[model samples]
Target: MASGSPLQPTLGELIASLSLQLTTLVKGEVELAKAQVAEKGKSMGLGIGLFVGAGLFGFFAFAVLIATAVLGIATALPAWLSALIVGVALLLFAGLLAFVGKKSLDKAKEVKPEPVANLKQDIEIVKDGFTS
Candidate 1:
């Protein structure tokens, strides 16, 4: 053996270093993706919360409007009977909507674990390559 530059690395050392760097790169990429997904999830959750809040308020507004309409109708008809008739009709409409919504939900596809599946496939392929 002869003296060499301090910067020089043996073949095995170089390969080890490359492997370490590749591992770091993959870890960094995965972490970055996780962060991005977390951020998007937070935003999506906030948006959904806001929409639900709006929907709740809208439902209350709709109820108030319905009550007003029923009271207006009561000017000619009996107030109690007017309210009962409107309430029955509203219940029927809501029942129809609920049935339709249930059918739609039943027909909807379940959330697929596509990312995890792809990652598993990739790992398997890499494992196979190494084994071969």
Candidate 2:
């Protein structure tokens, strides 16, 4: 056989080169995936943090509005009495909401799907067929 030239590779060398290249490609792809996930995670974290900040500001704004309502009422009544009236009204509204929420939950719990009954009947029929 003629001597192999510099440009010619044996079968084993070609396989080894292919394996090395594939491994490098896979590693590069994994690194790229990791970096992409990290960037998305940072973006999601920032968005959630901004939402929380907005919620905090909204809460403060709502409190200010409530205070303004109390001040308005105080002009016509004693400050303490006006505040107490507003507090009681808020409590009553909360209680009404709680009662309605509980009723909705109870209704949801009471729902029995027809599919479940049909499934149970199917299971019983299968069992009876097996016994026969």
Candidate 3:
């Protein structure tokens, strides 16, 4: 068994193997990137949705306030008094929005792209095996 023919590889076979392995590696990377991008896209979409919801709600509130002023129920009060009360309420509402926006940003910032990280790790393991 000591003497044997050389362990030779034909060009076609070698190219084929390399091509297959390259394709696999590329596919794995694409999968990982897709997972990460998908997660980020999902978060982006959610953020946009939240902003849209807030805008709609704010529009409704604004209309309601305008309606209240138009209804003339506050006419019993002095004009200056009514204006002062509305100003205070607006200030309070603005402060509440600031507080809420800060909290929402904090929560959203905490969202990690776990799907991407896990997929990347998996891809790395396989890639390493192939390279090694």
Note the Cα lDDT for every prediction shown: 0.93, 0.94, 0.86
Once superposed on the true structure, which residue ranges of model 3 sit more than 4 Å away at CA? 1-13, 71-132
Highest-lDDT candidate: 2
lDDT of 1 at 92: 100
Report the Cα lDDT for candidate 1.
0.93
Model 1 spans with C-alpha error above 4 angstroms:
1-4, 94-132
Q: Write the per-residue lDDT of candidate 1 for residues 53-105, one digit (tens) a residue.
A: 99999999998999998999899899999999899999999999999998888
lDDT tens digits, residues 16-37, model 2?
9999999999999999999999
Better of 2 and 3 by TM-score: 2
Name the regions of candidate 2 deviating beyond 4 angstroms.
1-4, 111-132
| Model 3 clashing residue pairs (backbone) | none
Q: Write the residue-wise lDDT of candidate 3 on 11-115 in tens digits.
A: 777899999999999999999999999999999999999999999999999878865774453678876677677778778999999999999999999997799
Error (Å) of candidate 1 at residue 121 is: 27
TM-score of 2: 0.74
Q: Where's the lowest-lDDT run of ten residues in candidate 2?
A: 1-10
Query: All candidates' TM-scores?
Result: 0.63, 0.74, 0.42
Evaluated at residue 81, the lDDT of candidate 3 is: 70
Better of 1 and 2 by TM-score: 2
85 in model 2: Cα distance from truth in Å? 2.3
